[model samples]
Target: MNKDQVKGVGEQIKGKVNEALGKATHNPGKELKGDLQQAAGKVQKAYGDAKENAKDNVKRNAR
Candidate 1:
């Protein structure tokens, strides 16, 4: 996987942990922060996926 993909997955995992901790501790701010992090991670992952797909298409068409 690309750097963006790896970082995005890491952020998602971190967000999930933070979200769980926030829920357990009754911290709305932390929970909201986690939710935002997850969303950002998702966007980054999608961008990485698009990049991969484009690269693959280019390589295939080069033949």
Candidate 2:
């Protein structure tokens, strides 16, 4: 997988951990931040998927 995809997945997992920790500790701010991070990660992953798809299409056309 590309760096973006890998990084994005990492961020998502990190966010999930943070969110769970925040919930366990009753920290609203941290929970919100984690939720935002997870959302950002999802967006990044989607972008990565789109970019990879476009690249594949280009390569196929080139052939």
* The best candidate in terms of lDDT: 1
Lowest summed-lDDT stretch of 10 residues in model 1?
Answer: 1-10
Off by over 4 Å in 2: none
Per-prediction TM-score, please?
A: 0.96, 0.92
Query: Model 1: per-residue lDDT, tens digit, 1-63?
Result: 788898888899989988998999999999998998899899999888988999999999999
lDDT of 1 at 58: 100
Instruction: Give me the displacement of residue 39 in model 1, in angstroms.
Output: 0.3
Residue range 2-51, candidate 2, lDDT tens digits:
77887788889888988998999999888888898898888888888888
Cα TM-score of candidate 2: 0.92
